[model samples]
Target: MSGEKLSLKDLARKRDLLAPGHRLCAGCGAAIVARLVMKATRGPTIVACATGCLEVATTIFPYTAWRVPWIHSAFENVASTASGIEAGLKALKRAGKLKYDHVDVIAFGGDGATYDIGFQAISGAFERGHDILYVLYDNEAYMNTGIQRSGGTPKYASTTTSPAGKVIPGKLELKKPISHIMVAHRIPYVATASPAYPLDLMRKVRRGLEVEGPAFIHILAPCPRGWRFDPRYTIEMARLAVQTCVFPLWEAENGKYKLTGVSRSIARNPKMKKPVEEYLKRQGRFRHLFTPENRHLVDEIQKIVDEEWNWLLKMCQLS
Candidate 1:
């Protein structure tokens, strides 16, 4: 093994791999996620970004926040574009025409691209067994364009399209379990991480990079303006997400599940999980969830989360 100790903090520096003069809004989670991810990955790592907030905000005209070779693709073509790059890299490596043998390919996309628009392309890459790392920095909604509901949007989280009203209280359906869907792919590695959990997130990123086949890391990123929360509370909101069981940090490799980031009291905490209302109450998006019927709906969602957690505990042997 190399002499490098495994420390995400040691690995990540705040000295602007993405740079300090970027155009991201205050407390932009995508920008933070991008920086952390780039910091974790060493060598000639190339990034392919879709047409989203990060792409537009970072790269305007001749300027860019990225220090590595980065490409801007269409909204739904990041995965496909990354696949092509991977293929070319392989061919070049095979022909002894490539400069670096440690080149890692990464594709970054928002929730809309990963969960809805670019999903097929992502699925195709995985099925084809492309050797690349696809990171979905999920802010839960189509944040690039006004806050609209996407497949990753949690139940009752208000968006512009799924606005709360007298009868309709934001989104009525459950959040799409994209990490579970990646597990269904039976790929080499699959993990769910959050920006708040930077060390854990970087650990998983390193593991995924070491894997031979396709890998997926879904990062739960918080959007301040989109979620109607104060920009300063982004980290707190993310921490609460895992604490409340709204988001679980777990991994599935070679069909075996492993749950991480469990609180001290497993049984008691699972049964007495923090109310979804608490999470919703932080953001104005879910203000309606505080109402009687909507509060009940939020409870129902919590129950579903409990059931899933219990099942995962058995499948993954969580304490």
Candidate 2:
């Protein structure tokens, strides 16, 4: 996994680490993200998954979708469990009981697990500098648990817990800045990715595994059922998220930031980016924000997007 871009042919030849026939929802972005991440691997890897859609759908009573070794840990301990596995492997190798020179340990969690319930464990793992990669499939709300609102839910987006109402619109608070939070840990690698851009996502996963210390990749996985979008438009919504500067694709390595994928151009010329309204209109969760009385909320969301985009550009030294 050098800096060189992998050809589609080369990527196609790789074994499908996540086999088909799973119960994941059709057009589920998390499933796509998992497949691409596993396909990018160059060697054997172990996966630790939090109790989320991925885990439930992939590992039903008597079947599984994973081709490689995988562990389904509790919702709040995916990172810590992966860290322990990494430690055990290190000990085994040191005792000359293991022959392999390297084996990647990756943990996967949804927004509820990563941003709320599992935050402490994930933070501890990063703080301890464990040799593991943690990937957060941020579908905004808790899609698997009746579409409850989580910390990752964007402002004005409707959810089960934060439903739109007369007095209080949708979610009143903004989405958590998890990417910057991870950057604050000063880990070896921290990246933002989307399933719309498979190559970029794969590249980030590959880079994250290549690093020695703890690494993190936050992926914006759109939910068709929760977001109220067409199943076929999952990738389109993911692309719009990046094109509108609502979710930028970038990475921070050793505390230095650099834009990747379509975000590079958006970082250079903000005018090239699409309007946040375009992205909002495509999703039903934010449909309430389009009203004349609530139109100001759209402007507010746009303002926040601009502020965050500018902040990212400044951090990347592009502004």
Candidate 3:
């Protein structure tokens, strides 16, 4: 597969769509994800963001951080809202009332919205073939609502609702395979990315836009407060997730899969893969997994990660 075509030089020339003043935490990976995505877009664009950290932090009252046309949708209807927007644009174009030659319609939602609350909406939109790109900045938990557990949170990761106390060692269920779910939708494009790989992520964003039908990109966005990590390790957490094979970066175009970035390299050489512990130890949410009694849990988690990574590789191989 061809590597990420967009270079740092090309990206450096693009103006930042997201402004500097926002209420997101210091060293927030979601912010980086949004910025890189904005850089990838060149023409007229309209953004529809679900009610989450990005929406709340960036558009507080009269003040706004978004330089492009933006809309704020409810937690469970961003996809529906974007679908309506796309439909409206089509209608206007058919009537010869719209001025723009082309417009990119994108939706931004966090894990709570995308993986759970908004799943049905997204599924419907994709099935209806909306010309929109849906991006999920998965911080693993509902960080905007006091670090609550969500479908996107990995197993054994502690959250306020699923605390790592004496009886419970964090959440028991595995994280939902959302990217795979999107792929199953049979959309024109589906991808998994991380803010750590800006070139890879930006490339996927651009590719998703190029596709005619609905597209989805699931991005790992580390949260310092929610994940219990230092502010400086935001990007490190994103990188470690890919290196550990806990989150493999890949893209599926027209139902054909191909690994990308470090994940592609690691797929070629298994020796390049790091242990899942490297990723777990960095986050406070998984601190309990390192305990004497819970040590076996780490091995178990490693097994699952390995299995998932191999499954992804097989999909690409078969493709």
Candidate lDDT values, in order: 0.83, 0.93, 0.93
* Stretches of model 1 off by over 4 angstroms after superposition: 1-4, 12-15, 263-273
Collision pairs in model 3: none
Candidate rank order under lDDT: 3, 2, 1
Q: Per-residue lDDT of 217-257 in model 1, one digit per residue for the tens?
A: 99888999899999999888887887777787888887688
lDDT of 3 by residue, 113-188 (tens): 9999999999999999999999999999999999999999999999999999999899999999999899999999
TM-scores, all models, native as reference:
0.93, 0.98, 0.98
Off by over 4 Å in 3: 1-5
Candidate achieving higher TM-score, 1 or 2: 2
What's the TM for model 2?
0.98
Give RMSD to native, each candidate: 2.3, 1.2, 1.5
RMSD of 3: 1.5
